[model samples]
Target: MKEALLLQVETYVVDLLNKQLAATNYYHNAIHTRRVVANIEELASLEACTEQETMALKLAAWFHDVGYIYTDQGHEEESVTIAISFLKQQEVPEDLLSLVEQLILATKSEFKPKHKLEAIIKDADCGHIASENFIEISGNLMKEINAKNHKHISEIEWLQQNLVFLKNHSFYSNSAKQLWQPKKEINQLEVQKKIDKLLAKEKKKDKSSRFGRGIETMFRVQLKNHIELSAIADTKANILLSVNAIIISVALSNLIPKLDSPSNLFLVYPTLILMLFSVASVVLSVLSTRPKISNVAITKEMIKEKKTNILFFGNFQKMSLQDFEWGIDYLMENEETLYNSLTKDLYYLGLVLNRKYKLLRITYTVFMFGIIISAAAFIYSYYVYFSV
Candidate 1:
């Protein structure tokens, strides 16, 4: 019966593969069908299966994926329908046809084999999965998967799956295990080697991710703080400027010209003193608030050496935007460089601020003493001019 069913299937398969199948994919074409049919017949011989059992196995194998003629999925149903019709047309017995239909339905990959014949055929269909030809068969499967599903799975996922199947699976017939088990073990090792590789790849990825998150946050926070502080310093400078400007304005409007008259000559010394101090105070105020930018632009070499704050526009405004972005990304990649730039900028800016304050202190000192001395002179001269 196995031999007779073999002949029948071989006959049906030749025509179906040669031309009958629609949207017929090369991956599941005649060669795969033929291979499945051969494996089924071979597995039956080992079981010494009955004629009806053998025919049902062959019939299922041929039509198992016949539904592929219509669509990639649920081809098992199509195979069952095709088998029942074929059996009926051939005047094959009704009982045998029912068994064949059951066998076809059982071939749904997720379904566990329920009968001995079903088990044998199922094992045979997947037999190559554990054999040396596994890679070749897998390629066929990948092609079929891509063609039908329009999805491409990564090599690692496909390898993991094949390893799981071969490791967890077994065939009842002595021939399958004998012929395929050793190869399956080898296949498992190959898959493991790949899995180890993938794991290593993932580790490297995680390391890069951590570095980026940590350094980027640091750069953003520190730069923001520095900018805020600079603004505060500028505000303080502006306040000093306004205060001294008012003092200078008052002195100019009332004191200097009055000293020009000889009658006010008695007022001269004191008034001169007042004018000088007020002028000094105003100069000191201006110096304290003066913006002192570097005379020369910082260069690419300076940035490379980390001798300048390339991330700051004050440092890089002379440079092009393209150069600035490159420098920033570099600073981002090296957290040490970013910190160094910020520290340098802060230290220099602090020095400049200190100088401004020092000058301002002196200016206000001169203005206070001059004002006191000049006012005393004005009073003394007024008494001299009136007493005479």
Candidate 2:
């Protein structure tokens, strides 16, 4: 009689789920409920549960997820209410109906099972975690979440979440632990492997992004340093030019006119020597400050081949504005070409700075020795002429 009643309950619950369950309830459908029913029956038999206990467990499994038809959150309480109402109408004994209601509520994720029956149902509900098709089952659950919540989750993100869940979950009953623990551990390792691979891929992408930024920073800093050094060289050259101009002007105005007199005869050679050194210093200084523009014309072919550096004004000065813009656009589209142009610009700028500093050093040396030699010649000529 009890077996006949159990059969009737199964038919009714299956029909109700098929008719009323939402289409998006992929993880909580009649199929999932049937799996739980089969799992519970196996666990009950393994644990040597009495006939009455087994019947209560089967009833609980069928009604556990039916509450999903009405709501998603706090569905365990709704499931208990639905199960008790249906069992009462079938003239179930009050004690048996109460046990079934408690068993349904025990399936709630937050509820801990208190005894053998509750433990059996709880383990049965999550038996797929140890099943051979765990990955497929997990994927279906993810799809159900996305469909129901109207959101999206990537495969890597889903695997990470599953890894955390697997680490935290454990079977409650001794029979379940013995049967499912080894397979559950294997599933955990599989989830971990997937997560590790995804993380490695993301890390590689991030590293490439950082490398590009680092290259840009290096170019910016080096370019600024080169410009500053060029400015300093130009300023030094200007100082030497002004000092030489003043010396030449004073020599021609004040000393050269006095050289025409016999008394100033000894001063003529020293005055000429001073003027010669001043002219040489002025020439060197001007050479240091002079701008040398490249005469090589940059054609469209050179730009396409990346043979000419469009970043430097001297390289592109002869090109028309339209041509220059086109070259720049091409460089922007190709990262390698753009970096090569920048490198060429920096290298040529370094060469220019080296030439400026070398000429400036020679100019300063000429000016320093010129003053010492001219002064010594004037002192010797004055002493000898006066002593005679």
Clashing pairs in 1: 270-374
Predicted structure 1, TM vs. truth: 0.48
* lDDT tens per residue, model 2, 204-307: 56644544768899999999999999999999999989999999999999999999899989998889889999999999999998999989999989977878
Q: What is the clash count for each candidate, in the order shown?
A: 1, 0
Clashing pairs in 2: none
Best by lDDT: 2
Strongest candidate by TM-score: 2
**lDDT assessment of candidate 2:** 0.90
- Kindly report which residue stretches of model 1 are placed more than 4 angstroms away from their true locations once superposed: 1-8, 20-26, 172-175, 194-388
Q: After superposition, how far is residue 343 of candidate 1 from its true place, in Å?
A: 30
- Cα error, residue 74 of model 2, in Å, equals 1.8
